[model samples]
Target: MLSRTIIRSPGRTFSTSTAMLNRCIIYTQNGDPAQVIRAITYPKLPSPPPNTVNLKFLLSPINPADVNTIEGVYPSKPSPTSNIAASGLGSQDKPVFVGGNEGLAQVVEVGEGVKGLKKDDWVVMDRPQLGTWSTSRNVPFHGVIKLPATGLTEAHGATMTVNPTTAYNMLDGFVKLQEGDWVIQNGANSAVGQLVIQIAKNRGLSTINFVRSRDDMGPLVDHLKSLGATKILTYDDLNDKSLRGKIKEWTGGKDIRLALNCVGGEPTTAISKLLGQDAHLVSYGAMSKKPLSLPTSLHIFKNLTSHGFWQTNWSKTHSRTQKEELIAKLADMMKENKIRAPEHTIVNISAQESDEEATAKIRDVFAKLAEGKFGKKVLLKLEDTAT
Candidate 1:
């Protein structure tokens, strides 16, 4: 049985059994997250098997895809596990599916034959749908890639797997762009979009960014520009027939060979229209939830090509060596401060809180995200509340 007693001291209060207990947010069925998901305290993980290391997740992010996954909407799904055997009041008999797909973890215990990793080493998941929302678990050595020893924060490590990786891959995968080349992308204010802007700039590529009109558009525009966007425009500006001519002038009549799309609908069509001959447009997301519509002329006459990109698939297809190299390169960029971490807020889940309390807190965060209340990206600090 796990102890839930809270011990207090002059300047500290913590669960007496903190080190002995492991906690995870889980669901047996896919549905509304708040309704289906709940927290469970399990036994601290046993020593890992050969080639595996016990991990203590430090921080996890609450991305939109995570929420959709809880609701059974996302295509990728996490398998239910009996490994997390909760005790006492919140114990479960059936297998439970853990919630979360990205996180930063520290190796607490390493099994026999594990090489090059030691205690307290920071690492990030290399694959998707690994159920990252936990205090601890044992993972195979190949399932994680060790992060650089310094120059990264909990938020950066937790988030480096998804949006940033997406942005990095999108820019490099679909198009072979040269320095001074121009790229265009919609959803310029998105996390991935901001990264694309910065990374493209770092590569000496210029980006024409488009975003939705908002009441506080000025500050948002400034933020994107500060991240190295060459030009920022709203979706409304796409209605102008003269925008293409202006883009051409801005690019000095050079071909805009690459375009990134996250927002579908007509915004996608509008950006596709700006690409020069033999250009590639890559779509990773569709925030508008609308189909991508394009004229046949662009494909037939201009030899324009369209491709879809998903970072999860990319990670799975790539080798561990490739993943390590990519992560190391990005870590250096973080160290140099070339690519700044996104604006974010941390949601702390303390060991002191009961399963119900922790679940409610997480559900509230999701509710806020659904209603567009959280102004910044949310990172989950799911370890001991006191620490």
Candidate 2:
């Protein structure tokens, strides 16, 4: 608790009578992160602006896109800055960008004019490019999005925005799919792919899932099937020349109208060959680090449209109310236990760690992520999020 409670509601600022230090993953230059990323601390925060709030980090995910953005390859990049807030960040010789794009945080202090959020209330960085890999931040009221703290665990709330919403929109936004309509997706065990299986199951849509062959492939396949995948196939199955004919016989000439491809290269090409006429092939990722190759025949004769989907872009174009409705819908399913959290590895970033230790931990995690080790989502859970 603060020594004195400063309640400034509409046209006032909170007095800087209290001190809060913020620790963040900061990158002043984009390159090999092993050489650049650092941990910086903000000694104290001044009074919040009339339209802003102070938030302490709860849990932030380490996503592939976040890594790429740090490497300076991703399209949606966070702003490099030395002056995003008065949190003592500008002392650096050069401007820097924080790591993380998605995470859950809790409000600790609010500007008098801030509405809908209060001390101890949970919030997620609903909007894009807001650097989230930090212990705390002073964010504009409009830039922060709040979620109920009880329904979602740190993992659920931290991750709820991007992948689930992406899968939800791709399924419901592009096509008018009926109960029996079929959808096929590569990377079936990916965070988004798993969500697709559950959401599709809930909507009565049949899902055909494909994953890379692994030693534990059978168990993975079973797990997905339990999540409601109608069928699971491996990349090897896609290569089987008899696959299309087999699908034709099994599906009884059913139209597989949509395909989600995160693994590109041959896998994308092979899946495109199975779509019905005028099907939509949405590419959201290229885990294989290869370009998408669609058969000319599939496009020319079947009239398939190859497209891209970015959840960030979608958020920009749609209304916040619409996004809230979708979040509420997802929440209902979560409350019903229809949405299960994915397996993940948590790295604790507390207020006590030194810069070297934090940097080493970050490098270690990134190495694993780069090597694709530990088939689980990596999350940095903060130990100082309490209001």
Candidate 3:
């Protein structure tokens, strides 16, 4: 096996002789992100393992799942890395966990046995929980998927694996939907939910999108309509008996075959009731922090099915070819202006920013996220081309 070296220090890329210190957000234990997450620096890496490739972070989105993982409440957890010792990075005794699950990066160096990849190629993690919130790191190449630099924006590619894939799979995986078919989902304004609305519209399928009721839901409604949503309803509307009559009238007797549930509780019950018969409901998240409560009569009389989906686990059984095909199709749609990245606010954690500056900026972003201050997704741009 063989390898190469490329070092990225703050403000500039450096030669092998001068190692770059790596800045990362890490947590040793689970708790509120503000109290638990810390910023640390690791010395420049040594040569990569034969099958490993060095990646310079391009952009990473701060997903809710990532925060839940840090809070020790997520199903997927970041594996601990022993490479960073107490002697390096931090003053603590044992190694800690790096944060973030999804991101896009550039291949800076490849070990000898690595094939079909080279310096300067863009890639995204094929799997999750391998940290991507840092400036650079060496990772096993099989866990990453390559991307053409021109097709998709850094934000689109960076956020692809989780929310987009979840949307694509939820639409395709559960049922054999035909043109004019209807699907319903709560949390329909979420990134995945918006993608579902667009993809369904693209394929001649219609969606009944449900979001939480607010004083004024005009913006989200107008936005989803632009993305081709067939029907948008509030939680309060879902609770009303007349809503079903309206949905039926809109669909013109077309069957509602699938219900996507991310927010549980009554919203889940409401959508479940809309399914005609033998329809499937896929649950991916519980942003409302409530248990899914479905009436037993639906299962007995209507023959409804309830399932949970996790994109990270699905990747393990799929082929690289299959994954790339979906990515390319979505990117092509984006290129044609048929679909777009979710609304997002960029949080800069540039390599040039000092430790104090970087940490403060990161903390501020998390604070906003914790406060639910941003209606759009928050993306972390750390490298030159990330914007």
Candidate 4:
């Protein structure tokens, strides 16, 4: 139960007598994020229920998927809750849904029957859409995984559960790649793509990275190359008929057996054509907003196979022990500096700021994201500055 003293106002009732406040971004209905999303400060959460723990968020990433979810375009959906009503957070006609899919949090309070978790332990969400964009909340123990005791920064922990895990799985789950083998992919500048380049390099595999032409192509190419990309090409480069021949020369005529596709449509098909017989083509995203249309000959004559991967589905089917094991392996790589955190900017939300000011700051960030203005990742630091 929450330790609060109820107070009645002219038209509504709210809680008081608490020094600490819990604030989160929320929306009553799905729509344009700029218009629908707002921040609300509610009473601090009460003590947790059985097998649950109160988590104080350290940092959370504002991923594109989070924006899509709030717009009701993403497949994953967060549940609506009235838990914050007593403090008068949202409309009484409808429960509000909190926004965020990924975050790193520390356990501040643990409930009965909990094992292997206590106050001050760092953890990440085990599943998706649990409303991670908050100062703190109570989550079931099973909903979070205690991060490994590795020398990982808050940035690494905050972003690890999604992009890195996706890259790691897409490489290992789809095809059996060996040393000296080659991989091809588009969207190579994305967070997941950068990780793929480094992770593949760590396993002695080579990658052919492709990205859209940009004004600052030189620096971008240098960055990807630094991450172990064998070759970086713009989509426009694919128009060259000799490009395939040149790729053959680069890999010493070796069969390009694996292809990772995030951008669908032409680019995806173009990469698929480069794969050898019996190779696997994995599709994890379609950034182009177009359908993938491949020549039937590639599937029939070349014996190529196609598959799709979603980390959420994988987590839903796998055991907690299995998930922890994979995370540990990734952390080991992080310890060795084989895979590093992606380029990102931290957007801090201070407790001292008024609710309107905080809301404007977040919406501004989202507006920039919607306009493709933020070239790097955005991480949220919802700090309790007043404390």
Report the number of the highest-lDDT candidate: 4
Model 1 Cα shift for residue 81 (angstroms): 1.4
Model 3 segments more than 4 A misplaced: 1-19, 85-93, 383-387
Indicate the worst ten consecutive residues by lDDT in candidate 1.
9-18
Tens digits of lDDT, candidate 1, 32-103: 886788887777678899999988888888889998999998988887776765653323557678888999
lDDT of each: 0.85, 0.80, 0.81, 0.86
Candidate 3 local lDDT, 1-387, one digit each (tens):
223366663333433323356667778889988777766666666777899998878788999888899899887877887665434643345558888899988787898799889877778887778887877778998878887656567777788788878999999998999888988999988889999999999999988888888887888789999999988988888657787788789988877989999998877987898898889999998888899999999999999999999888788778889998877777777766677887888887665666667767777778878998988898876532111
Steric overlap count per candidate: 0, 4, 1, 0
- Report the Cα RMSD per candidate: 4.4, 4.8, 4.9, 6.8
What number of backbone clashes does candidate 2 have, counting pairs of residues 3 or more apart or in separate chains? 4
Error of 2 at 178 (Å): 0.9
* Model 1 stretches astray by more than 4 angstroms: 1-19, 87-93, 384-387
Candidate 1: lDDT of 268?
95
**Candidate numbers sorted by lDDT from highest down:** 4, 1, 3, 2
**TM-score for each model:** 0.92, 0.89, 0.89, 0.92
Question: Candidate 2: TM-score?
Answer: 0.89
lDDT of 4 by residue, 246-316 (tens): 99999999988889989999988888888898989988899998998888999899999899888889998
Tell me the lDDT of candidate 2: 0.80
Root-mean-square deviation of Cα positions for candidate 2 versus the true structure, in angstroms: 4.8
**C-alpha positional error of residue 184 in candidate 1 after TM-score superposition, expressed in Å:** 0.3
Rate residue 35 of model 4 by lDDT.
Answer: 82
